[model samples]
Target: MKNWNQQEVEILKSKGGVIALANPYDNLVTTGVEPWPPAEVVQKLYQSRQTRAFSEEEKEKLQKFNGYYSDFQSIHSEDAITWSVFGTIARAQIEKRNKFISELFQTLDLESEAVESSEIYLWRRIPHPDNLVPSGPEIDFGILTNDTLVLGEAKWKSSLGAAQGKNKDKNQIQLRVEFLQKYAPKLYPGVHNFVVLSVGLNNDVTENYTGKTVKCISTTWGAICCLQSHPHHDELQRYLAWKIKNTKNG
Candidate 1:
């Protein structure tokens, strides 16, 4: 049987009084997963394009919008990394809370790949000055098969606030909502019906503060309340207590 130790580790990180990660599979490259489709492919595709075919005037017009294509090209080919702890520590928090994303992917029949990398930050568009390209996202989770596409955002934060240093406190939930509405039906011609995950929390995450303002999408900034009621609460509690005992003995 596959050890659920790593699974439990993610749970512990989100819980109070539970510290230190459990190495379940003994895998290196902890907390980061690189996505498939290497970057070289993207570079080659960009080179093969016949830029000469377009007039200089047309090229200028396109260059103005190069930010969109540049990012698309880079993401398509770059190695994607998702922080295992930051992305989705408690899969149940997402899968169990939102039946729509769970069923949505099931319908698409795409096997979800769990990546251990920081690239998930990209997918989540964790609020950052440099990451304004994607902004927040209307939808953060998705299933992409050979041809089909289904996308949605999952919200599991404790509360809302001014994440970007702005005095205006924006509900973190709304960031994902606007993302899909802004990009959907336009970025990809075939993609339709975007979805967002609306999570609720009964705890105050802002009680703890850092020097700088943090964005809501940053999984690290997610509220503990989001993880408290999660189905795996008992399992996590058990695992951490056991780990603490073993550590003291050693």
Candidate 2:
């Protein structure tokens, strides 16, 4: 039997979709749009990275492909889903965006009010607060408001990654909570609302980690699709449903 990634690629191809290529990366072929919805936002954030760290290999890979940050064509791309769901919401019209965010917080059972403005950062690198480790975890996506910060870790066909090098004591979510408590204050002072959202196939993603002050919650891609019921999200919803069905069959 073919593995999950193979199956996903085949499914996309069968539906007239194409895998993204390094040379002249085309978002139209990969994600059904010439310019991704979050293109401008991503470019702005990437350009503002003064202290962001990337390994030599990572830098080389990024230089080879402009689409490496989004990577929507990859079969197992969590970034793709993150961009589709949260990014879409962030870029939506003010009323619609506020509604979507309110729904999201409601889904997670967190008390929140819609904000006039917010920022969504994809793959944000937060350095270690006290040099406890060489580097800190790169958050999958973070939604920042005037009074709240929602840090998310999205997974597709995978579990939460193991602890960083030589740091087996804390899992991925724990590390993010550590950043929220220890490091995030410096960046967004007086922000009391700290939430760690785990987006994955199931609620089990939240079973491994707990935070003292940060509230942690898990929701599946399907749930997000349901909440974000816009025409733009139809393709993603269908794709995730297919993956879930196939995964269950296997």
Which numbered prediction scores highest in lDDT against the true structure?
2
Identify the candidate with maximal TM-score: 2
Clashes of each: 18, 0
Q: Which residue runs of candidate 2 sit more than 4 Å off their true CA positions?
A: 1-72, 130-135, 208-212, 228-233, 245-250
* Cα RMSD to the true fold for all candidates: 17.5, 8.3
TM-score of each: 0.32, 0.67
Residue-by-residue lDDT tens digits, candidate 2, 22-103: 2222221134334554463444323213112344444344345453333443444466566666665655566666666666
Predicted structure 2, TM vs. truth: 0.67
Question: Which 10 consecutive residues of model 2 have the lowest summed lDDT?
Answer: 8-17
| lDDT by residue (tens digit), candidate 1, 1-250 | 1122543222112112212222211211122223422232233223314334345544444344332122121111111112122233323244443433333334334344331111112243433222345354323344332233343333222134345323334444444444445554455465443433222222332233222211122222133222453344344344333432432221
Per the 3 Å backbone cut-off, how many clashing residue pairs does candidate 1 have?
18
- lDDT of each structure? 0.31, 0.60
